[model samples]
Target chain A: MTMNRETLINSILGLALVAVPLIALGMDEPFIITLATKVAIFAMAGVGLNLVLGYGGLVSFGHAAFFGIGGYAAGILASHALNYEPIMTWPFEVEGTTQMIVIWIVALVASALIALAIGAITLRTSGVYFIMITLAFAQMIYYFAISWPAYGGEDGLSIYVRNGFPGLNTLDPISFFALCAVMLGLAMAFSAVLIRSRFGLALQGARQNSQRMTAVGIAPFRIRLVAFVISAMITALAGALYADLNRFVSPTMMSWHMSGEIMVFVILGGVGRLFGPLAGAGLYIILEHLLGSSFEYWQLPLGVLLLIVVLFARGGLVGVLAGERKHA
Target chain B: MFTLFLEQLLNGLQSGVMLFLMASGLTLVFGVMGLINLAHGSLYMVGAFACAAVAAWTGSFWLGLVASLMAAAIAGALVEILIIRRLYNRDHLDQVLATFALILIFSEGTRWIFGSFPLFLSVPEFLTGTVMMPGEFQYPLFRLAIIIAGFVVAVGLFLLIGKTRLGIRIRAGEADRGMIAALGVDIDRLYTIVFALGAALAGLAGAFVGTTQSVQVGMGEPVLILAFVVIVIGGIGSIKGALIGSLLVGFTDTMGRFLLPHAFATFLDPASATAIGSALASMLIYIVMALVLFLRPSGLFGTEA
Candidate 1:
């Protein structure tokens, strides 16, 4: 395949993301590997959001709900498994599993279902209402997480051991980073394919002009709803990985700030750019690490940077690197 | 039992009034500017911090209140001119991001100045005591003051919007920004004024509530979310909707916490009942919001989009 400028840049970014961890492993810098893993996981969540926000034009301010649900899914199941407790004991008994595959499946299904319900209601409203309703629903879940004591509530739940992968020593930071990086790669590939598909065109068309799309005999609502659910599932998967990386899950993961940060990853990278989230997340984590060590008030600089980006830099890092997207 | 209910009801009204203050400004900003200011809460924090600082230095609550209003309005106007003015034509996504960035800046800046500790503002000496109710029950005089203040603002807002010349310009601007500008209304100045007005109301709320709650860096956020719920339920651009929605949310939230656990205790064990009750109560307002939106997507009083 011929490599265009954007594609070449994306390839370099993808390679560098993996190369950083490998180099860190060679140098035995485990903390660097872990930070890279966080970037990968966060980038994956941003990828999920980019599908909806970038492509579909649905500004869901509640993607954290899926991410948190994913984290909790891992946390809850692992806790129950360690304690030898059944998650449910009634009509049909279900026990928790410390298996990573099981955890991912649970996270995906739960997030998809919740997204469907939330999308069904929130999709009815467009523009500002859509943004606010999505936020309100996420807040609902955040409060529920805080108040519900079943799985530790506001204190959060922790996994004593990393959930097992079939063949990997998940305890090692490099192995975990590889696992997360691989997942992020797969999510990006999937997003690229999805956006290139016929369904993707429909979704984009709806975003640009829903009325016109409707005239062309497509229901924008269903397309948006589907995109919303798919977007959530991917983010939820990231949340599961994040939980394993930290060995913890807390309501903080579901907070509005988390949602804002995830959105920032997309915006800082360049909305609609396939690799935007990864670029944005990588930049953000690096800034946090560098500035956090030096300045006590790192967020002040971060906020100023973001404001400048919004005011002046219409496109994000990828936009600066790759130039404006050529409309086909 | 009756007294307890009445007390909770009054508590609900007090909080509802606080929410109304926040929501009125938010709705007005959205209505007039068509901009969603996520950093409006930051202005509230500015107000609280301003009030706390002034009151602590001068030992005068009334003076602090005035300081809060001025501080928040000035901050709001500055933000509008410097940043928000540019975002008027951008998509909501851009506005949300810019404002979200503002939140980060405002919060971290305040933290740098105030340190990480919370500040306290004492209610003035005369308003510190409790007032007697009809059933010989007593309520905090400060809380009663908040409710009264909220109503006064509400009435004042109605008259200002309904009876005044500035209100006419604002309403006209909301209805047709281009048309008003074409007719020589100085739309930019009008937007700045509307934004400052909203910020002042939010500041007033922060100052009043600061006396009851600790003035802290992050206090505005939770209140901001609650205020968002109020405006969402009431309708985005409607002050009347905000007032009604604020009362509903406040009453439902306070009463749900007060009543649900007892209602559950009748059937379940005390511990579990309290746990489940509080959990549900916390989520009760969001559920109400969803229901309201289901029935009326624009909100209770919002114009159909």
Candidate 2:
């Protein structure tokens, strides 16, 4: 309960994330506001990944599956709503809605179900096999998305208008940014609470020593699977937000590169740190903006920077700023 | 119908052979060094680029092939010494990220050097035309040559691993790193060699396939993923597994794409059937992988986890 350097840093980061966007809005710089929204959405996805990867010790390399699922869910629903068509008419009737809340719910449920199936199979293997399997599964989905032309296939689907939110102009950059930032805050708070709960303790325990946990009568598999599902839901939520932010959805969301970038956010911010994803996402977006505008081959420098972080700066930005975690 | 099936079968075998060329190196590295090199794909790209550049400059595909092997092997050795050596003891996540960074570097570096436009590598004149098969069916001679070349390399790898002192050291290194080090074997040199060997194989595959497809940046990724699928299906770290797994995947994928739409057209409307069939066909290998994992998590020939 004592105030700590990391907590202070986290507080500053959260506030700055919102304050900058607000300042951008006041200055009529909507692009900066949009960029900040991207940071928030990417950070939220990173947070989702951190739960299983950092806390549960399950390194999933295919989280983009859930992310794309969320994106496509939003895109499909919005497209159907715009076209005045039913999403499903078999067994019963299902209508598409432009409601943000409905899209979010659908995204979460769909991601959870898919994650459960994926995790049930992938979680059976550990180490390299797990990583490869997760990656392959995501690629499978990516290929499916590219070939399945109903929702635009390789071209992608774009929503003509941003989906509705009650009493708010969802089309306004500032309004959308605020919504994304708020959702990010909620996700961080939820993760913070979940990590400190008894279930969180058990999850960490399993991660540290599954054999020891088994000896103490705890089943690691179920706990990890639950964490994995929860992680997918959070990321899926971010994906939906991201799709709305761009007003478009595509298979690029589910590419292995996206998964790697998500992992980079967690690593760049310092894995397991509460605000690591925010810090990482902020730095990454800023670097992308700055380097991208100035250099033709910006990704070259980005890659070098990433290599430096992995080789020398193991703790990432948070680790550099606040020092290493006491327990770890 | 039979001729079409025969042609598809040959296509599957050819692609399967190329998959083996990639997978063997990947599985070897994972087995021997306990490392997964995502940049293995970059090395493939390196080979393709190297071959294309050399072939274009010299006007000879043969010399370009040689350049590809040397270029890729050199790149592999440098990367092993500079980056991969440090990663041997780190957890998988660190390795994954570092290699992912390497991908970015390699991809961008290639683009910087070659520009964004794809370079083409043509098959040598000797291997250019189609040949008569049983039932008077014609197949691309280049593809048939790829299958033959792949088998030749597979045999070469088997003999190298089974007969040579270096192979003994590699197998030993896989079994116990500590033991090999204690025995005064130059472990660093050995690792560098294995990594380069794997890289060379990947490069060779890239060079070969480069002729059939456009030689371009980012080409190695899909093959890399397919190789991963092959290794996973055949069981990680098993060469025999990589071969069998590669063929299984190759056959399954090629046949699925070829046959699925027609099969589905039996019931569904042609347009819808083609759409559904191709989508499912693309996903078939992963489904096979899932089923394999569901039944045998360690893979067919993998050591029990």
Candidate 3:
């Protein structure tokens, strides 16, 4: 008569997803809607990272490369549209669109292509080498972005208006939150589906034992590369939303700190868990809001808390709240 | 061209020595304990801060240097006992996270202590002037002193690792941790000493640097990345490799920036030349790394396959 963990979790998550927005609606609180929207976007980024880091076992320190690329994709496109210039032209004219559908797809594709290139070079090494190489590559990109004067460089590009959605006015706070929620839901669904698929199983297998996966007739490189690309795409989607949220995008988004923070979010949420990123993001935002509001030097306290978590609380917020699942 | 080459060579050697100081401790810690302490840089920062603060208070650079090394070593030992001991069996990701958290704590802590204002330390009077060389060129005595100091440390470390009884235990532990454990060596104590020694070396590098430039918060980060690059280019666990790799990186990085802009200026406009050259200069070492990896994936002198 007892329900299984999977079904119970699915039901609870499903309910919470619906309940959170509804609760915000009932409260009629703009602040709650804004908070929920931030959580949704960050969760999307976490889900993206979980694909490569959690499943593929690729500890890519350069993921912010994709995240920043995605933001720039959105920024450059919109700026081009605003200024009536093409992003890149061939025989056919290219134009930017405000529609989330076009924006998201373009961002995803741009990031994936870049990820493919970076992953190809970096995936050659394993272990600490991989971590540092990816980090170096990411720093290279960050520096390039900082030095390049076009598109605002270090100061960054700002969006004057929220990119449009066909049926909704994105300038409205709740409506914007709804847009992020829908994207987050879709990203979560995509991740769940991807992990359950044959490719996902193989990717997980590669992480567990790459030699065994190869012995079974799978090239771990190709599988990991694909997973890395998909992971980057998802993070890129979040980056687009994040830029839109702040109405600005800069080299800081591409910074090594941002990359570190993204990795921190994944680990804090419980690395392979479905709802972990959401939980982690929610916890992080709340901590930042509360601690940041309370003191001039709140980062000192936050650093201590993170140290405690890393040292003592290995499973993170989601793992503590739920329970540990075997590292997939 | 000869004068330019000589200047770059001296610059390269100076840069190499600074890197050697940082990389030696990093490689030693990695070789012995098999721990990647990203926070080795923080100890460097600590040394710089100590040097700057003490020199300012006491007005003796000599006293400041001594304080820097001792403070850094003590801090390193404490961190090792308190936090890093717990991380020995944990995943590398976990170690990285914990150390990264330490960096945040240390950086903010220093900022709090130092008030974000960069502190300056004047060079000692004895090392203040330039030494004349052939072809009417001159090099700063302090930079030359740094190179000599680094060479002295290198020789001392070689002696320490090769000659001392503790060095034997460290070597034995690196070769086979289980056998050393079975031999009843205090592995934990060995690890603590190794970590502290590495921290001391890092601290020395910082103290030396502080005398040359203003000591500031977050100064260790860029140097940390470069140190990582050095070890990767050198074999991860080889001290000799760290020295060679440091020279290679230091030369390439400095020379690339100097020569590339001039080379590019011949073909392109000044603005474009500056942009492209600086970018390429920054990327040169990483490019060298990629090439090295292509030929030997383990690195130039790495023991691992």
Best by DockQ: 1
TM-score for all models, in order of appearance: 0.99, 0.99, 0.94
Error of 1 at A154 (Å): 0.9
lDDT of 1 by residue, B138-232 (tens): 99998999899989998998899888989999999889999999998889899999999999999999999888999999889999999999999
Question: TM-score (chain B) for model 1?
Answer: 0.99
In the order shown, the chain A TM-scores of the predictions are 0.98, 0.98, 0.93
Instruction: For candidate 2, give fnat to 2 decimals.
Output: 0.81
DockQ of each: 0.88, 0.86, 0.56
Q: Determine which window of 10 residues in candidate 2 chain B has minimal summed lDDT.
A: B296-305
Candidate 1: segments with Cα more than 4 A from true spot: A1-3
Over 4 Å off, model 3: A1-32, A88-100, A326-328, B1-5
Write the residue-wise lDDT of candidate 2 on B83-148 in tens digits: 999999999999999999999999999999999999999899898899999887999999998899
lDDT of 2 at A55: 94
Name every residue pair that clashes in candidate 2. Answer: none
Q: Which pairs of residues collide in candidate 1?
A: none
